[model samples]
Target: MLWRATDRRSANPLRTGLRWLLSLAFGYAGYRHLATPAPFLAITPPWVPEPALVVAATGIAEICGAIGLLVPATRTIAGGALALYALCVWPANFYHAFAHVTVGSTTLGWGYHAPRLAAQPLIVWWALWASGAVDWPFRTKARDG
Candidate 1:
């Protein structure tokens, strides 16, 4: 099989730890987005419509996804959703990087942006892996018939 479902009984400690870490990270970020939207609003791409509403909605999504990750019934869907969320927000990262969008008076240099941009894919993969949506590079080959 190309992908293996995660078994809670055999769950990897590293993966579980990372999953909890991601949940905390996303949850906190969601709270920040809701409580103080100015930074997010500042980074929003100019072409996006209703930036404020979009920011608010994304915050809710992050919070929901974070919560979903903690529930076994919702983990897979949460992983997929969070992965897609990371992909969806990529453009904003780009805009921030290329346009030099400043959050408050702090203008982030490429040093910060480079790693973040590169890490985006890792984040998506992390969500998928952590939530058991996919198991790759670690899945064993099936026995021959």
Candidate 2:
């Protein structure tokens, strides 16, 4: 088997495979944004003053987090990185929350930003929990007898 039969949450190859798939999804999305940093950059405040460095660092962090999530040895680090990334990008989320954009002529409502903002903490929590950073709720019994 490609994966170990450890804790129930991570038991068997199927579950592990699913995890890798999810990680890949996040990684790819992050990569796309990294490849074209303009869309995200335009939203930042002019006084923030350092868009290039911010974009580069965030992109690298996302890419690294994605890579780390795939390997078991690096999962914990990945979780930490992801959690931090979520916190870092929060300002953009807030900007989107308050700013209004008109598409052609229709003014869309502000509900969309909720999900994006909520996603940060959710991803952070999931990454930490899924990576086994803490003792799982249903750990397998240790066979000492």
Per-residue alpha-carbon lDDT of candidate 2 for residues 52-141, written as tens digits (9 for 90 to 100): 778767777777887887777677667677777778787876774666543345434657777877787767666666555543443456
Worst 10 residues of 1 by lDDT: 1-10
TM-score of 2: 0.71
Query: What CA RMSD would candidate 1 show?
Result: 2.7
Candidate 1 has an lDDT of 0.89
Off by over 4 Å in 1: 1-5, 142-145
Per-residue error for 85 in candidate 2, Å, reads 1.3
TM-score of 1: 0.91
Residue 92 displacement in candidate 1 (angstroms):
0.3
Where is model 2 more than 4 Å wrong at Cα? 1-9, 12-18, 101-108, 135-145
